[model samples]
Target chain A: MDVVKTPQQAAVTVEPPPGEPVPAIELVKIAKTFSSRRGIVTAVDAIDLVIGEGEFFSLLGPSGCGKTTTLRMIGGFEEPTEGQILLYGDDVVGVPPNHRDVNMVFQSYALFPHMSVFENVAFGLRRKAVSKAETKARVGDMLDLVQLDGKSDRRPRELSGGQQQRVALARALVNRPRALLLDEPLAALDLKLRQAMQLELKRIQREVGITFVFVTHDQNEALTMSDRLVVMNAGRIEQLGSPREVYEHPRTRFVAGFIGTSNLITGRVRAMDGSTALLEAAADECLVVPEAASAGAGVGRDLDVTVRPEKIVISEDRPGSGRCAIRGRVAEVVYLGTSTQYAVATAGGTELSVFVQNASDADDIAGRGADVWLSWRPDHSLALVTTQPAPAESRSDLSGGNQ
Target chain B: MSRSRLGARLTPYLLVLPGWLWLVVFFVVPTFVMLSVSTQTGDIVSGFQQTFHWRTYVDGWNQYHTQFIRSIVYGLITTLLCLVIAYPVAYWIAFRGGAHKSSLLFLILLPFFVSFVIRTQSWNFILSDNGMLLSALKNWGLVSQDFHILATAPAVIGGLTYNFLPFMVLPIYVGLERLDPALLEAAADLYGSKTATFRKVVLPLSMPGVFAGVLLTFVPAAADYVNAAILGGARTTMIGNVIQTEYFTNLDYPKASALSFILMAALLLGVFAYARVLGTEDVLDVAAR
Candidate 1:
């Protein structure tokens, strides 16, 4: 069977129907700083990002990472300090949010409280001077699209959170903007509703095929909804890639730790050749790291290595050749239905976690306090340049080799 | 289990008891007394023996014809005028005041720091004949030197509007302040122009505040004897002045009570009628919020 490209993977080259061929929206070196009595604070640092025609891209980061600020800049709600925002390739710098061809679904779902659902959806069409008959038909169609045909006369406050969210979605989509910017659209929902709405949002995006630039702090949400995600930290793009690529081959320690659970090891370069490098682990043990780049360290320059817990094998006996092995006492054991996780403590007083899935009728690995060997192939380990110390202090001790 | 059930059942009513008591003591009892006195033919001082003379309403009506109607009309005009002026100011404060919002709100409320009497008296100085304002208007070719505003119906209306403007401003400001800005931006993204966004989204959503403000300004303005007594000529008399006269000068307590009851009934009926037209129950709920 031939694989079809998802909206995230598909190139956003096709123009939206019924419009002049132009770039949907563009921002060049956008920067925004807020100055108050408290002092000047740079909310959105000098940044550049392009949202193309009919694309579903996402900016993923924690709060205060400037993702929402970037979206606000594109929507013309906030004027860029030193950059230009272009809609359809035209500099939209003094154009108000109303004039911009973009819309946003706020996290709180800001439906007009006094207007009925129908009136709310028809607001944009009426503004555009569309005929009354056409407005009725268009608004009716949008209501049906959002599965709210029977609720046209109902006020927003009367609706449930999920229903209000759908009404907000229909209201924005009825206008048929060039792009839809969703700022944590599902944040207000409970877990179950949020999960359901994620799929619903994906389906809606597929059906509409409009450019969607979503902003979210949730890594799981971004991974599920986005075709490609830009993981951001401290007002800079840390990495941008497909979910699997970014998850498996994270280029930075932040990306590795931010995306999913991983075991980290800090070591110093002992020796290096063209293909592989030997490193002295923090536990006074030597490790052979494969596919490792030369650190140009003579003997004691420190380096960091990241290995996933699932990649390590915990057994009474060492498994295979060219695998880094460590002897440790099992500190704790947690059986998680499908997988068994063991926290093993090495002689260096660092605790390392090893997870192995239950694939066969083998007895469970050792209990807490049992001595064992933790092993993983050198190819599965990564030797990284030791840059700044761990950005998060909680993960610092865990990064020192065996821990 | 019995204790738990009793607590659960009584807690809600207990929580609501204070407000209910307040309403009964301050509102319901006064309205009942007014109703009784309105139906009495004789004055309250002369034992009225529970005599039900409904003609008192008619007499009250006939005695104050254009003045009663004029008071209501002037109140309506002042309320409408305040709404027109306040919506934009409230919108600016609510949606665009950025960081200095508390200070801006304080400024809007600053006039209330002085007593209403003081505020009304201040207007006297400003709008007095040959006052600085009159001189400025004459200098600017807007009014003649002989033309004055302190004794006219327009002066009373102006006084009423100025006195009650803060009342109108507060509710509208509250409504506008509570508005979720993203909703406006959402409307804009849906292809609404600034005017359209305001008209369709911001205006309708803020109507609850408008409704409350209208009620606050118009009801007080309609019943206000102070502004009319201070700034109005005999031609600018309102129903409140009539009631005051009947109570004090004429010593006809029953007739004054009858007039007060009639005004209160009219206000209630008007509010109900407005709610029906605008489908404003939800707006009122939001206003309360």
Candidate 2:
């Protein structure tokens, strides 16, 4: 009942007699291409993913990133143009949606407008020819679970958005499918309601113990609700890990930039000393990053040294230490409720963003044009080898020698 | 300022004035004149007078009651036949027409480009004793030489069905077009079989179009005179034929007016009953108000 565990931990503990239980849903190089007048559009590239049973997994990305396509393929709404999809051990390649043991909570909710809430919940049971009494009992139980017990006789349109959303959820979960697919089900709700529904969905998923594959373009929603998330870009997954891992230690420059704000300083590896690498970031400034961060790149390879704004400490006075330090002038200061963000232009012409927490007693707000020093630990800076050649605009703005 | 406020309040009425005026001149006046004529005693040669002869209604009904029953029965059969044929056509065009939906809808409307009387007359040649259909049937030994269809009730009913089929198709197509594809997918995902989904989801949602189609086809079919005149024998004479005869051949204006009024009343009563049976009174109520 403790829903706070990581997906891996939950997967491990929930399946009792297991060294490695079969995944609830597995995709093997599944690809989908739509043919239209404009020509071929690949919505989902060949991608392999394994979602563990009872894990709250998320496919997170910006729009047009194929997160929804991946979820629909799992739900049997869209057939993969190539490769295989396995549901628990069975390959459900040619199976229709009705035959698949999966139910989806669509973004629009897609509740039957003509049916009352109770009838909508009981539709699946009636389709299976369940007895009338059993169908009624199950529908009542589901309505109670979704906290819509007394409102079962009301039509979908007569209910509020949140109530209708719960009805959709109840209608899908009442059948207890093997896996539940959610395609931005909370996107239509207001922020406060969406946040509440996020917890409610998590609680219900825990109670039912069904593997949930949730697709969303909202980064915050993905980070908050998912135990493990795959950040996708252009029909392919950029990175897959626990939310904390993907946030704190992003594997790619795209992941670093997309998950949250990161100041990407372009550089090339200059030297390596044990666990540290010297990155020539600008004309006169050399940044020391963890050598392990650039482990896959050679000495001369172009790399991006990424650091979160919060990791960089900024102060008017120089912090005299062995930390990597750059002196800059505060170009702009943005006052956020919990933190102050400073846009600092370094003497080397590279702009560094730094966030300072606004603790009650810490009232030293750096004003614009204030000369300051930005410093961070070498281990905090991550060096990711650039996969594509740096674009000319980005390369010319680096202000450093090619070496 | 008060004058301008009055103008602002009266703007909507002013905008609707032309339409109301047109209805009053063309429809309301004609209907009122017809109502007065229905209650009058008259001969076409002299003139109709406002005699308030209510007995004409009872006398007309007493004489031509069989024709009235035949017209109602033909209307019901034609509407049912149109529904049976049009539902599949509308479903196909709406769901499966894909890139050709507009062209398919154009094809449904193609018959309207021809004159209605001309098309009904064409069925005469097709269903005649020596026509292609009967000739082929005779050649195949499917029918005897004496077998004929041109002047039968079936031919008249078939003509009614054919003439009003597009009326049934367009409204049903509109209903099916407005249906969200996601709803059908949701039904399938919820374990509904194709037939069950059609029966429970598609049919219920398309009721508005069916109701509209039925009204469009039935009302006109019941009052149509040309089909009964051309395709029906004397035994199959409908109320429309009797009304036509009283007006033209017999020159009994009072009896024709009475029959016309009775037809209108009967149709209105039928429509009301139909609405009640289909539980579509809400749609009608919204439309009426």
Candidate 3:
């Protein structure tokens, strides 16, 4: 097994080999629309994606972002309204799910209630007309893989939620299809179980060496499990990259805020000097950020600057020198075990969040109403060209674009 | 404190008091009275005396054994026919009826708006030798002029099936309604063919409803005399018809009571055997889940 690395270390692209094998699955300009009482609603827009063999790919987005629909289209449970879906280079436009060389671990776990654990695991093999002895042996091996060897006779209801999830995984994997599609298979487990299953799923994927297409609304799960993931919004791909690449250098404001907690401050470009651009914000306050971050924005153009909370340092004494600095009064202090968070009200009437690690040095703790200085490197603050207002209620707003 | 505790303990029984009283008055007491009457020995005018006349039961069974068997056969056939006809209709309503589910169910029950006797009689007209159906068949050269469906086993069974169809449909609809559609998709994803998926997932999941429907249709159809009286000939006489004749037409209460007891006992035994054969415990367990 490869050593588990931080997101930055794991950011390398998974380029295909010199002579690439046919992609396990290819979705070309696929679109899906549903006509309901509310009229036609496009669930998935023109989406083109190629999943390499043995790649752990993820579709990460909020609900209604078409991630699950895209997964379903690949699984053959749904037909695309336009474009083509190819499985191993074969166009599978009208193929039924049963005829496709793929299996899905449904969110509901959908285990056959009438069948025992052994029978459930053997279901796909039996459908394929595998020999009885081979089916039994394969089922036993799968049960052992999922750590469910001895409880074969037990029914689904008799098992716990985590066990049922493993059974679902076993059932899907026993078929040994070219790829496995999982639709939030761990969503039902508790927090600790979900975390455990995330690592377990990655381990199982590595062991089996089959392409895995996972769909989830949870950015953390996507970051932790996917080799490369696509962030989608409003039926379109917002950004696609490795977790570190998408997180560290998000190309769009939506991608920036969706992937993690970001502080977006809108301002107009006041001056430019090489890679540094000076922006005049509200209340005569001027901030400097990397000009390369908002390269297309000339002078007098409005742009948004995003800085992560952890990147901001809060100090009671004014810092001597920094590329970017803001004076604020601490409005709230939140102690979160490993870290302490402060919501600082800036002089420009904007609140900037700062996260400080809870080390043994208690000198950095800022109390409510304390005057403080928030500072970070100019490179740490990314300037984005202001785009259309982001959808409200995504919890992405930093200061006053829209509520 | 003790009195209050006692009141709390008695609350459940108090709440069920009305239903218990109704059952005892309408069902239990009448059943015991009939049992006593079945063992009585006397003419109707002599004020029948309870002499423990076991011979009455033997005599009733011996005299109408063929009719008893015939009633069971008709019940079996009616139940089977109701299942075959109701399953697909119920499945469609449960799965595909969508926004019109309630209205489709109402249509299934539309026949109940008219009287059951009228409905059975309406079938008598439809299946008569010179009825519209026979005439149409004759014009289409599908049958001879003398070919008739009325006054036969099929006619009586058909009437029973039509009358008890709602009983079969409603339970199965309830069962199928409770199914999670994802199970079928999962089966298909697992490489199960359409027919195999239906047989493995859809059929087994809907068994509880089928069982309930069968019980509802079979028990009542077995003891029903109206359909046989209206749509059957003398050769198609069931045990229910003989019991009715013994009491109302022949004025023989003892034999009638004995026949009724036999029918009830036989039905109870049949239901017990059916439940045993199908592993009712497993069905109940799955349905409960």
Candidate 4:
């Protein structure tokens, strides 16, 4: 899919067929800015997103990357400086959160401390004036779903962190809103508990079939849970695609670096070999970027590319022909049980990371300071754009950031 | 290492020595002295003797039962008034005061810089008939020349409310101030209206503060005679005024001590009942934490 979708494309997505499924939430040209002591800071540059019904979507980004702000705008907790947030089909910018058909799970869990788990879960239903019997049955069912049925009478403080998180989930899901917005719900959990809750949350989402808009800075969390995820940076989306697509085919330098470890290389197109552009880097190093990724590059234009560590194979001898190969010496080696990571330093002062699966309990092919060859398929080389050609300094900064 | 362990064991007691000594010398001794005086029979001309006159309590109650009830009634009214007046002020300072929250809190405490009696005396001056405030109000037709506030029950209650207002504001402010803003957002996200959020989440969470403020303000306001002396007359005489009169004017030390003990007992009983009615142990646990 094309990254940075155009306004025309976004407009085309607004109206679905009469019988077709509609988007659960549509953020159209949403922009938020805040004036602080420093100055006017743009939190979320105008962006468009259409999250489908029952889709587990994530806005993944680092801190201060406008992911939480976007979720807040969708939940109606915050007013956008510009743009319209549509819940299902109705515009809900001026509507208060109480009037919106959405619920949020705060990062802090935010369960009412003074209330029992039953009362906390029953809060939304009570607000909606749900019949007492129905509210009890529904809250009871939700507590069961989250496996907190027996602890309904207990206060939030009495529960463990993971249990409290389940209570928070039950509280939001009890209302059965059109969409559930979760802001780093499991960020507070330990590694084991967090992984467990991730699957648990996914299972609950599937069982309830509610659209889940999860905001998280953890790339692994987003990749593992989201049906589709948007990678945001500096107030705009760098890319949006499935875990495989975003991981294997990141579209920008920021996305490539932010997702996971990637070997960044900047070079000028020395020549075009049919569908591949031969790139020449510092110290006469040669690499080939595919024509599909570096389409704008001619014989002399500059290009940037990234290759994932797992894609590059490290060998004791030079790799065979038909693959891009570079001679380097092993700089460092880290033995992970499943896979071993090797940092290969080329003569051009480029340190390319290569992760080779430890297929057997044998010694690694190359040890530290051993001469080795790193090679990857040309198709795996992803050309990156700083921002669709914005400015000179930023382009320089992009190259500066690659190393 | 053994010596260090011994020092560590004694550290807590050593640290507590000053406070323990202060309480014993000031509070414990005076309480024992008052207890003894309460059971003695006395006359101003012929000095008091330890005759175990426990009947003085019954006589004191019989003579001043009206004042005791009035004092409690005034205390309840003043507590309710303070809660009503302080909750919003505390809420405003907590949620809306923004950058000026500390300054606003400082403003609430500013009047406390003046002596308590001086403040009550100022209220006396302001509420006095044909005084500066009454004359000004009369000139503006806000009140008639026949209007009066001094030497009335309401003036005394009003004085009590104003004097103890900060005691109510500070604790409630602390409770509301410590409230997590995310909880409010969560409440809103759960589809709660503004009023419902305030009623359910904000009010219940701040109950600890209200309970604390009540404890802090009610006892002192109940035992206060300055407001009664300055802003009240015959009908408004509380147990505090009666105790003062028996202690200083009537020269009946036995009756004064006995009445003081009765007032303390009544206030204690009232507090225990209030705590039982307003708070369960669970709520108290949260409030205490």
Candidate 5:
């Protein structure tokens, strides 16, 4: 019920299932550790996640962030080092992939090259001891659903990459699995095809009304397709929320910078209001940020602030109408068709980037080396908790006196 | 064009030409000569004339017809049996053997290092009346002491199977080695059980290996007479024994030559038939790769 009706829609309204709890998939404090020559690398930290039935969920992160590891654990290909994976209230931690009611479309689209398209799609049904007539009919319907009806006789190698991708989808979906796991399914396609497949995948998930756990490193792909995304970093979850909720209200500096481009301003808290904080930046500039009402932090404490580029406006003179203003020198101005990017240097000798849209040919106001005043609405700047460094000495050693 | 580029292309051929020429002169020429001599009939003292009778082939067939046909039958049975036994072992060694594979494969090939004749002769000691195998069978009450296994049809067939087992294993191992493990995993993910996965995916993908192993076991088994000479008496006198008898005992070179060429022709037809079914280039080149 939380599914988006249109591909272009950005809003998601979740409606709970009818009465009973939808025990879709629950991982109870899952931990996975791998031993290698390097050391015991914790591929997945002890974390819990509950993916509801019929939810299009995504595990989004950068490469080597353990997002894929989480997906694999749920697919029954891997067992957690400590915890249990429950699908529909049954423990599936030790279950084999074939025994689980889940199927994964591999990153390589690992379609069986030996079988015809029809056989590949009908594989699971036959495993369940479906009659020959029923298997044939179901396979035919699945091929038709994937827009590959008549091409069932063709071998996997005979199909193009996109068609092969569709065949893989059909092969995994034909069994009516309780959940479909996609591991970078569209990462193998070119840009145009990836975009097209993203929409097609979302549409297919909608039509089938099945829980789809999609894994990807591409932020845009996650944002465009997921009903909810769990952003992972270094084997831990950085944030988990709806795409718009996470994008607009990132609780951490990592989440803010990762979901899109943003500037991190480290500072010490100078003063605090009920829902706002005034801070003195590391570069000696003062920044005012709106704080979350729940985080009750006292004054003179270290904090981090996040400001999106598009939210900040650059003008030659002080815009007296704005809530907050900072003086800076325009370092560079690069025009990209619809918008312009200005890299500016603040009076405190810190560089800041600002993105200004060309709403009506306002290019003359923004130019290279022009002194300007940057301002943003008071509510736009976010005051987040400054993640603790290992130690000041560790930071100094890592920097090697570069500062 | 460029000297290095041309040299690169020619280097492979230059390195390969000596071997190619060796095969053509030693193997190709001898096969043609045998084919020619197969169609002739004469006594050794008279020397083989170019009679081109071709009826000598028919006469050779009539003289050793039962044995000649039985060899083919034994070859087919051995090949089928080898395929059934070797396929799973080869698949396990290739896909599931993991890091211990190299050592296991070496062990399989270790028996061949001692020489085929030695291995075939050793079967006699194992299958003889007073041998450990027959004695153990007697102790176990599986067979009577008067029931002789040596110098029988099954003994010759069993010896052939043992002699050429590595040949059957190596080709199948090669085929299975080239198989991609991901393909099987994909089949399993698509809901195939262990058996269905092997039947639908693993078998078809490894056909090149199966064909190679079959050809390897069949051709040599059909041409060999050593097993019959050692373990089989007059009961299992195959074509090779018939040829040996004609050439040495009866002093009939023309008849022996005719029999040799007929056996060679039968082998060629068998290979061609195998190629037609499994694809010639696929089996050979896959194993080679």
Candidate 6:
């Protein structure tokens, strides 16, 4: 280990077991730039990634953040301006999509309108000149996998959007390629249908035992469905980790704000005690953070940290010295069916958001203008490594202060 | 209230009255008069009367059967030639024209700004034996002096094809435009080569346009006499020229009307057979998709 802890590189790597087989997909410094009339737009910057076999990998970010572009490059729908793409350890550069060993389910579902579901699924088998009986059996099996066996004879236009999506999936998966690329396949469906399909997709991926690379802008979708996901911003990877690791320990400011709601606070280290640092938020108040979080920095160095709302407890009295605590007046309260959300303004003029579960007829603990104490474990206040300006949304709820 | 309800019921009729009146005056009365005249018997000087003679159809068919066959053959050849020449143009404009699509389409249709007769007449200058192009080809030994294009079936067919190229291209362009490019990408992603992708997806989806173009151009091209009159000699006279001559120079109204009715019926039967063969239902379904 080096003297300096580089969380950016460590958090972004999801190491497979030792002596793992060849990766299903490997991107080596891939980049794509499109020249438009306005100017050249860098849709995807040079980035390296390796997706393990049988893993549900995701590239997630907001729209135009290069997730879809990266997926397109993997599917061979796009050619990288620079870098190599390896499929099962073979460089796939210059190979047309038809010759590639991967299939893509497009955002529009791209099902052949004139073809029946059966024919669409059988298309790849037919291209490979599979026997008629085998094509029929394989198409039947694929349709069954998608839960659309009886409807195989129907044309794509006659089916609903969700059915069309299944047909698109079946059409691609029927080929049994090394990997499957899905570009926002669930974005067109209604919310409930999308959720159902997410689980259904996971189940199908498990049953097929093929590598699945899913690209989506929906953070919750990625978090719930992906074994590991790469959070991207502005054509670059912000962080990559398993969903829990990313949600709990985001290494960058963008990842912290993008994955879920969090309160960001800027503070300066006041004292270092063994493995924890005390920050002087005010004359008599101190904010405690992991000493490892500010490891490379000396005292008086400014740092930004994030604490998830669910980790903070709201009560009437301040916590003991062992825990970090702050006093705030509840600015607003929203009753969110299972949890009550509080927006509190501290004496330091920092706004903090807190989420409390409604356990056994729980009601609003404190109304607007009522004073409340917010406390959490010292380690919960994760110090973000990247010095990027706190995202605009997090700045509105600065939480690490006790002035 | 009842009166107003009646007035509301009459609104649709009132809105359509002008169009109905125009059709009645221009189409219905002329058709009935022609039907009556088709069965009359007369000479130009001796005048004519309604004899209800039905043999006129048989007589007209027997006399100009060769010309009728020639007209159908010419029209079929022109339609096929137009399709061959227009399909690629339409595909290019629809798929690759990009920012210049509208301009390219305008260029395809630019000849329509000139009169139909003027456009057909312009071909006369191009195809004439001593014309600039043909004469130059002759002087360059590209053709024998006797190998002239003027007053031939190819000249008339070429003229009709030029006159109707846009009819073929526009419909195909509209059809190809309606096709989702994703469908093509999907075909390729499914391991279809360029040729296979075109044969399976592009050709099938563009059938509706081809069908429409065939009808729009064939119907008029078959019934047209202008190209034959200007660009053809006596050997190349079509049924349309026969009909025109019978009605105009020969002053034979009954024969002309009978021939006109025969041509109309033949075209209707031919198009009906075409529709049956191509299956408009399949084309319409593909279009809908």
Judged by whole-model lDDT over C-alpha atoms, candidate 6 comes out at 0.86
| Candidate 6 structure quality by residue, lDDT tens digits, A91-143 | 77777777777888988988777788888898888887888998899899999
Per-residue lDDT of B103 in model 4? 96
Model 4 lDDT, full chain set: 0.87
lDDT of 5 by residue, B1-289 (tens): 8999999989999999999999999999987887777666666776777778878778888988897898898888778777777877887889889899999899988987887778777888988998989999998999986988898888988888877787878877887787776677777776567888888877776777777688889998887888889999987888888899888999876678888877888889878886887776644553443
Number of colliding residue pairs in each model: 2, 0, 0, 0, 0, 0
Kindly report which residue stretches of model 2 are placed more than 4 angstroms away from their true locations once superposed.
Answer: A1-18, A281-286, A291-295, A347-351, A385-403, B132-142, B281-289
lDDT of 1 at A383: 57
Model 3 chain A worst lDDT run, 10 consecutive residues: A394-403
In candidate 1, clashing pairs total 2
- Tell me the TM-score of each prediction against the true structure: 0.84, 0.91, 0.92, 0.93, 0.84, 0.91
Better of 4 and 5 by lDDT: 4
Q: Model 4, A383: alpha-carbon shift in Å?
A: 1.5
**What are the clashing pairs of model 6?**
none
Pairs in steric clash, model 2: none
lDDT string, candidate 1, A131-217, tens digits: 899889989998887788899999887888999999888877877877888888888889999899888989898988888989988
Q: Where in model 6 is the C-alpha error above 4 Å?
A: A1-18, A283-285, A291-298, A387-403, B1-21, B43-48
Considering only chain A, what is the TM-score of each predicted structure?
Answer: 0.83, 0.88, 0.89, 0.91, 0.88, 0.89
Q: Rank the candidates by DockQ, best first.
A: 3, 4, 6, 1, 2, 5
lDDT (0 to 1) per candidate: 0.77, 0.84, 0.87, 0.87, 0.79, 0.86
Q: Least accurate stretch of 10 residues (summed lDDT) in model 6 chain B?
A: B280-289
lDDT of 1 at A74: 79
Q: Which pairs in model 4 have colliding backbones?
A: none
> Candidate 2's C-alpha lDDT?
0.84
Q: What is the C-alpha lDDT profile of model 1 across B50-113, one tens digit per residue?
A: 6898888888878877777887898888888888888888878877888988898898888888
Q: Candidate 5 has which clashing residue pairs, if any?
A: none
